[model samples]
Target: MLRERVAETIYVFTSSRYLEVAAGLIMTPQGCVVVDTLPFPSESRQMYEFARRNCPAGIRWVVNTHFHADHIYGNYLFEGIPIIAHEETRAMLERVGEQALEEAKQETPELREVRLRLPDITYRGRAAIRLADYNIELIHAPGHSSDCTMVYIEEEKILFAGDAVLPVPYIVGGDLNQMLATLQKVQSLNLESIVQGHGGVLLRGEIPETLEAAINYLKKVRSFVHNAVSKGASERELLAWDVEKAGLSRVPLGGMAQELHRANLLYLYRSFQKERLRRAG
Candidate 1:
């Protein structure tokens, strides 16, 4: 795990490599508010200790940016602090949290130490969480996942953007269009920096280009998928299509990149087919 302080009270922890997700910590006058916990129990414990030593306040709350295993599997470490997230996030976790944990365990032995904790506090739309001196706003950002949320600290002007703004955008919620909109919303914000879910933080100067890159990639994928489906192309052919020629070379299909790519193609294909059937009916 790597740690860098974005502001006096804000810090970003990321591994930048495989099997690890970035997490953020916000210190307030009252206590420390964690944006999202790391993937493993030991890493979570390390972050907890880091908070105890650096911030006067301990962990007051744990926020789930999304229900992905890399972000929420270490929730058990903060058992007392209320885990906060979007209402849909909680629901999705309730539906698939355990299965996700089981699958994660198969990939990594570290997850065996994780206890699979879900959200204690949930909300819809936008919600403002006020700490002693920090104004953290939870905004619903659905694209990468239907329940993905971004945490913005008003004072620091920094955003914990979750998986919504990774080096390569991953579209799992069947809404590549919405994903672009979500990033556009972030682009409109008065942010000094953005802490991405799996990679390095983006400074103010780098924000626009990153957002544009992601938007272009999603647009290309959506357009290509739509055209292919209209022409009755098979999913296999779509998978074999040259992603770079289609303008998705910047997106790192890392980890299970191939699986994610295959899933995205099928998702768009199925969506177009269903729309066609609905229209015909």
Candidate 2:
């Protein structure tokens, strides 16, 4: 139900589950291509129904931005469709698909009867999917997640940036440097709009500035965490460091953003320690 027509033939749907997880649908002459599927089965079904009513042609393909649970839980509902994603995405799903489903089952009764499904088509590096009127270029951009890929609709001049772009950029176990690098690369592309997985949309003029802002945030976090690590800061102290005190603006994360941020700090700290140990050895 959380869906909207963002453009002439493009529709976006968000799941109410959490983080307002978004998926996109592009209606083409041949058929419809779904960018990502919602989290809950019911919500995802509704999304499909809406598409079916509006789009007479059946689905041509389903693309997963990443293998994250929220973005991929509805793969079952999309049976027989050629599900496509980055090759690494398929690996991640194969590695953790069962475990993620089990955990989700424990979290909500809605997921109790759900089954995990994976990508049928996988590509490494990049791929060009030729649609009837548009060309979708799947760029494997690893940052927010190792399997993350940005889908650029050529003719429409819109980019469906998966988890690679967020309202408040969040880095889990991904490489901080790689995140910045990918953002910079995406900035150079000529695009009219960017549809993020979370936090709605970014228009043409606002795109560069917002990408820079996100890059700056990641840089500030990395610098602060690095400095803290250099000063004999314990893991607890590193985790407790305030982002605001580090001169970064507060972002809406339901307070759990701090926990994730701290976890990022921990990841950086561990990386630093490993490097130092290697040098010492």
Candidate 3:
């Protein structure tokens, strides 16, 4: 389920999961620039085919949004293309990528033979690539992971937000405050459409509303945990806080809502403790 469309010189490859999540290919007279390889090798191959069929020219630039397995696991599919990523992403890939590869191999033994490749070019803060027709800006948005970046095509008013702007919980290990701030930064962009890492594309006007919902959700979780902690509730007691109170019980987050909620609470509690200690100091 991939949707392909040409917006000026850029080709948008949107996923079918409610038309959420998308990768982009910017065609230049020199070559093509690929943004965020898909999760699986098969999907990466499909993307490659999509590019070749559409552009005929080869890919020369591959920009990875982060070190998440679902985002960069398809690096192997690109073979000789020069892959790029944030410096933090490079570090994470070097440290945890092999472990993730091994885990994937256990599920799909055929992938065992393929080795994970780290990015060749890494930048901190910001980086930009000037294609023949467009300038693609990669801005670091590290709350989601110290490595997450948002890809923006200034000419097209389109943003490939990676996992940083999903409608669901800001998972992938994040700092709640930092995540909220990052969402605010994204909201400030002059975007026409936001291609999220999951869920369908969001219109520009919808950015603030969606982001506020996510932020409010996080704030509610934090408040819930704080009150429980003040009451001297044990971790078990806190964990038992009703989902209805969290306003997420009916969201159909599969069966993992409980697990995610538990994790979110733990993270919030730890963050709260850290802030309290800083104030005490």
Write the number of the candidate with greater TM-score, choosing between 2 and 3.
2
- What lDDT does candidate 3 reach at residue 172? 38
RMSD of each: 2.2, 1.8, 3.3
* Global lDDT of each candidate: 0.82, 0.83, 0.76
lDDT of candidate model 1 versus the reference = 0.82
Per TM-score, what order, best first? Answer: 2, 1, 3
* Per-candidate clashes, comma-separated: 0, 0, 3
- Kindly list the per-residue Cα lDDT of model 3 for residues 95-189, writing each as its tens digit: 98898889889988656656788999999989999877778899998777778988998888888888787655654377777777788888788
Which residue pairs in candidate 1 collide? none
- Tell me the TM-score of model 2: 0.93
Clashing pairs in 3: 19-200, 20-199, 20-200
What tens-digit string does per-residue lDDT give for candidate 2 at 64-92?
Answer: 98999889888888878899999888999
My TM-score estimates for the predictions, one after another, are 0.91, 0.93, 0.85
**Of 1 and 3, the candidate ranking higher by lDDT:** 1
Candidate 1 lDDT at 67 equals: 86
Candidate 3: list runs displaced more than 4 Å. Answer: 6-21, 240-261, 270-281
